[model samples]
Target: MDKIRIKNLELFAKHGVFPEENALGQKFLVSADLYTDIRPAGLTDDLNASIDYGMVCHKIKDFLEQHTFRLLETAAEKLAWSLLTEIAGLKKVTLEIQKPWAPVGLPLETVSVRITRGWHTVYIALGSNLGEKETYLRNAVESLNQADGCRVEEVSEFLVTEPYGYTEQDDFLNGCLCLRTLLTPEELLALLHKLEQEAERKREIRWGPRTLDLDIIFYDDLVMDSRDLQIPHGDMQNRDFVLRPLAQIAPYVRHPILKKTVGGMLADLEHSQKI
Candidate 1:
């Protein structure tokens, strides 16, 4: 990843805890490092292929002047999100907001807030075994697409599969999807739980029947294990339903820990089941 650096671009904005500070306004310095791949632009000598620092500077200035927030943290957070969301070809950003005039009256050179934010690629598995199974799966996809800071990039064809556990239940509609989001793993998990609850999912039994079941299969080739969640989905390599749909969308996506491609895992799983 390459960077386009913008430093100490001064602007006048009204943002403060004090009433007079908001009314009178103050001088603030803003800086940013825009991360992106500039190789294409460099090779072609094309400005369009690269992010324009000049345009980004204007964007930062306009955003600061237009929005009023009491805290520098809030301003930097919102500004970073705004730039990442609006800028084309921008993958990540490190933003800083420096306030030279402090109301604290302590002899301080400057007060500043700096933060980094970026988008992440995630893969999610979707399943439903009760109440219009297909409908639940489709609605879940739509819900994820409409969620803030999330974009559904690809979806595999839903397949009807026999229940894996608690086998007495009905067959499920299962599939996988690729998502581009700004949310962290935990935040994404929370959103999934919210959607599941909306569908009236209940976890009374292990692998119990449910109106909806959402699992995080992978998060940017990341490997993590916590009490509530597991990346690479602990049992994905053993579940045909998960791998079948996932491979359809991302056959070459490698598991972070196993270092095996989704397609290879699916093939291995299928071969073992036969033997």
Candidate 2:
């Protein structure tokens, strides 16, 4: 929410496509905007409460000098990720890497790459109906926690519930997980699919029994409609299995489109069922 700007910090580094350019080294200018909550630091006048700009600049300089990349895009991406991963109390970062002296014959001002990187809050619903369901769920959580750029913050207690889509299959062990990650929604989806495949998940029938089922229930309050995925999972509000566990971890997590908390949604479902 708050901004700490570091503008046009110059660095001399050996980063270029040409062999001669790499050998000789070049001058590059970097600009970054660090986003975080600085209220505590400002109010208490505590240095420890906030990130030190000097340290950030030094870290960036060192990173540039230590690594050699042929493309500015690669450098910018790595720098942005490094800052987000290394910096404390950082919510998001916008980094720009500028290379002024280009080999292009035209007299251009500068060539640069700019990108925004941040941590996203995602809610995942995990379930399994076959082959040690509890172990499958726990292992899935463990795998996600061990993943790079992803952190499992909270997990709801697993609940044993009857199958939802088809009554023929075994009852599923279901739960919810709260995660903070640097991966985009698409990337996260891919990782989930990979984990499922590793568990030998079969897709012969829609909502069929599986070794493990991990679904993206919500992603940072994002409301998305795509052929492959949908955010605020289309049927989550109506599914007691999903809301029951999700409410345990995030009772107050509001649905972006419905503007109702998970607890409220669960209550509404209960009320409707009774009537």
Candidates in order, TM-scores: namely 0.95, 0.97
What range of 10 consecutive residues in model 2 has the weakest lDDT sum? 79-88
Model 2, 1-275: lDDT tens digits are 99999999999998889997788888999999999999999999998999999999999999999999999999998988888888889999999999999788899999989999999999999999999999999999999999988899999999999898888999999999999999989899999999999999999999889999999999997988888899989999999999999999999999999999999999999999899
Clash counts for all predictions: 0, 0
Model 2 residue runs over 4 Å out of place are: none
Which residue pairs overlap in candidate 2's backbone? none
Instruction: State the number of backbone clashes in model 1.
Output: 0
| Top TM-score hit | 2
In angstroms, how far off is 146's CA in candidate 1?
A: 1.3
Residue-wise C-alpha lDDT for candidate 1, range 1-275, written one tens digit per residue: 89999999999999999999889999999999999999999999999999999999999999999999999999998998888888889999999899999788799989999999999999999999888999999999999999988989999999999999789888888999999999999999999999999999998988879999999999997888899888979999999999999999999999988899999999999999999
